[model samples]
Target: MKALISNKVFRIVAFADLLQQSAIWIRNISLLFYVMEQTNGDPVAVSLLNVLEYTPIFLFSFIGGAFADRWNPKRTMITGDLLSAISIGVILLFVLAGSWQAVFAATVVSAIVSQFSQPSSAVMFKRHVPGELLAPAISISQGIMSLFIIVGPVVGTLIYSTLGLVYSLAAMIGLFLAAVLVQLTLPPSPRPPERRAVPILEDVKAGFRYIRGKRNLIVIAITFACIGLGSGLIQPLDIFIVTERLQLHKESVQWFHALSGAGMLVGGAAAAFLGQKLNPRVVIFVGIAFLSCSIIVEALSVWVYLTAAMRFSVGVMTAFMQIVLGAIMMKLVEEAYIGRVNGAITPLLMAGTLAGTAMAGPLMKTFTLVPVYGMSATIILIAAFASLSMKLGGNAANTERSAVHLD
Candidate 1:
């Protein structure tokens, strides 16, 4: 991990990512609490927030990927941070004016810009990181993200509760500006070579065709989509679980996120240590299976401490799954196609997320939290079993070796 961090580019990008993720989580948590307060804990409003947050991915990720391939990644990242800062600045104005509705618009705009920024970030990893160190790099990155996940909610809630919405928005604006400054330190990344003139839609279609031809990529993408669905179903319900089921105040919700983040920290450390030794396929399968079981236990248990422990366990397994799957995808695709391949898979994942969020309100209204959690667990379990058939683990080491050789 130290060796990977020693690389100047990786260090810069990782730090920038940490700040960016922190800003995102802080904004999300604050907005969620604010909305809950305004709507008097209406489930429908919460679900709508989730939808608005993720809908831009469905709408623009493919176009973002196409452009990421065409543009210099460094410039793309800088521009994204700039745009995000401006958007937050606008929101700050609205908040100062006492208009809360603008917060939702800010969320949508942030998500849209993220579609471009995320692919560019991915491209940067592919461009700068050595193939041999990729897994560890990703693990290290995830570890930092987990750290933010632990702290961001607590900090966000504190700021929102004490300083109020305007101050929180100002903090977010500052974070985005910091990210942009850090991004400027990165060396310029190469742009893809010009090809014979072709329509952008055709380029996107070709990307899909490329993925469709690869069965392993298809299986992995589908499994991830399922995981996204399960995640979506449960994510919006966490607040309800704490406030309604556990009989805790809304402010106490950060404890659950903090505990989960603690687990992620542990899981990420383990992945960084063992990522190269572990079979990627097996890691993903076992992670999902354990996560499924944990979700089930969490759903059935009403005790706050016990449920918190289960949520922690879920976080650990989730870290393992995410780190391993990311490494596998990076190894599987050629650098040139990384953007498009990621673009192709994002919608399937976001579609599942959108569907689950759309269903969460009605499901909770009709049946309550247990059934919703139960449904999430069941879907994740199915995804776990289905992972057994994937060829991800087989020849993974050899593939890495080949990738290094190609580089």
Candidate 2:
């Protein structure tokens, strides 16, 4: 904890993340309430907001990552945040002009810019943070996100209720500008390598090739696909665990999310303290395996307390898996390729998520809830076993040799 607090780079990055997350939640909830009010709770309009937010991740994540690799990490992050603030300012003007429809632009523009900024931040971490502190650093990052999950919505709602849409948008812009200023305190990034006469397309393709050659990266990519599918498969059906399985009111679902968030906060702390002593792959494997069991238990249990326990356990394992995977990925990849590697792996997760989310509803209609949940858990279990094949243990030296030769 002391080491993490003393690390100048981590402090800068964490502060920037805090500011950005504050802005995001404020923008998210404010827009949600504003749109709902304007459209009289029209489901299509509300859902469109989600589409605008996520579609950019599918469309631009890889492209942004490629650019992040080509640019200076610190500069790219600052530019992305600056662009977000500028775009939000423009949207605020539109709102002031009575073009309420322009509120959707705030979600889309930030979503698109974050893809570029996020990978740059990862690259910066890879560059500036020592490998030994990587796990704790990632744990701290996850803790911030988890903390927001629990508090962001309430804060956003309070701001929107009190100040209204225009002020909320202004607040988002202010928070973003603050993030940009905080990021400016980041240590100067190393100069970017000279541009090869290579096209960006070729650079992207090389990223694919690089991942293909690394055994650990391949395992991580595959794990992401499985985790994505498993999580997405249950995303739409979680509420059913309350309404149908436990015979409780649908509103009871909030407890599940609340417990999960609390669990993530605690789990992040545990990971930070224990990370150095644990093997990353083994941690991931055990975490996923535990999560798979929790899903099955939750799906089967009619007892509310039992189900809540499972949800909390799932959150803890999720924190462990995320922190470990992030630390290991940073450790495994060279600094030069971190952006591309991140870009390449992320799409698989997103694609799996979209695919599973699209299928979950249809599958639930066709089969019982247990069967669908079972299927998801089974996929996650497979990922757990697959993680065991990673050569991070006794053959760690061999893997490093292979990675260097491939590079």
Candidate 3:
């Protein structure tokens, strides 16, 4: 029962995250639309914009992770959030002045600013929350932000379209500023200890060695990679399916995403309330299996509503997977190496996302949306098999070591 309630520090952190996420969702969608509008809906321009957005995640995630470990995570978050706000402001000013170069540069910088906080946020969760509660906490946190994701873009877009671009930019800045304030109120995380005995390169090498020493770590990394791949494809492809394939209206596209978010939110809430009793791995597997089933049905369904229902199921499953994977990550990795582990894991996921997105565009060429997305179900089934077949108990050494420490 005590686990249900977060400390003041955690509450502030959570609130800050919710705000950050809301702003990020609105910002990403707005930027994409803004770029498309500026280019007069050229596909090349849209693709380039995507490249700019995702490139930082691929390149600097490791560096950012290292920075998070080197500095105070809370301070890092505040700095990153502030940078993000500044980036948007710059873009807004440029757009108002009709400077395309400025707009493009600002958009590119925004991705870098956003990526900086990724590691710090994970570090904070590791520090403030107990391992047992980490999954549920993350699930809850994600759920709240996701719910905003369901509505923020649509409303922000409406405001942007009707009220003007400046208003949309202002709204994004306001949300980021709010997030910064909330983060400021949270208790500061103590900085990670510097390892004087080893240089940075050696430290990175040591982190790699540590992972190599554990088999479960490898599986976990691979699993996360697959998850990322699935997400990148799922998002853009699902939109394509809903609007282009199913003959849904432009406004209706938002509802499909909203339904998916709603399902994930419900699943997350349930995990937050009851995740302590469930095995983390089991939860992830169940999610994969459920998504597999949903994908199959979605492929065959002639109606748009059925696709929405499938998206909702996938969301629920993703929530469970998130809870379990997050907890395991916190539990298994050492404090010194969490940053590196995260750094390594994140890029694989990024690569996977890239792979998924890249393939999604072309795959639709060979087949209809139904059969193509339906194929994702097979991938999920593979994930379920992988999850069950892999042994998480490979870290018995650490478990034994901890037990010995107690004795």
Which candidate leads the pack in TM-score? 2
Q: Rank the candidates by TM-score, best first.
A: 2, 3, 1
Ten-residue stretch with the least lDDT total in model 1? 398-407
* lDDT for each residue of candidate 3 in 1-407, tens digit (9 for 90 to 100): 35536466558777887777667666667667777777898888777777887787777776666666677888878988888788888888877888754555655776787566777777777887776677777777777776776777776677667766677778878988998888888786776654565455565566667676666677777776766676556656766666665777777777777887888788788777777787666777887778778776766676876777787877777776776776677777766667777877768878877888878877878886766666666666776767774455546545523531100
Writing each residue's lDDT as its tens digit, candidate 1 over 192-213 gives 6656666788778877776766
Which has the better lDDT: candidate 1, or candidate 3? Answer: 1
Task: Give the per-residue lDDT digits (tens) of candidate 2, residues 162-230.
Answer: 999988988988988999899889999887667666787787887888888888889889999998999
Best candidate (score: lDDT): 2
Error of 1 at 123 (Å): 0.5
lDDT of candidate 3?
A: 0.72
Runs of candidate 2 with Cα error greater than 4 angstroms are 404-407
Candidate 3 lands at a TM-score of: 0.88
lDDT of 3 at 215: 63
Which pairs, if any, clash in model 3? none
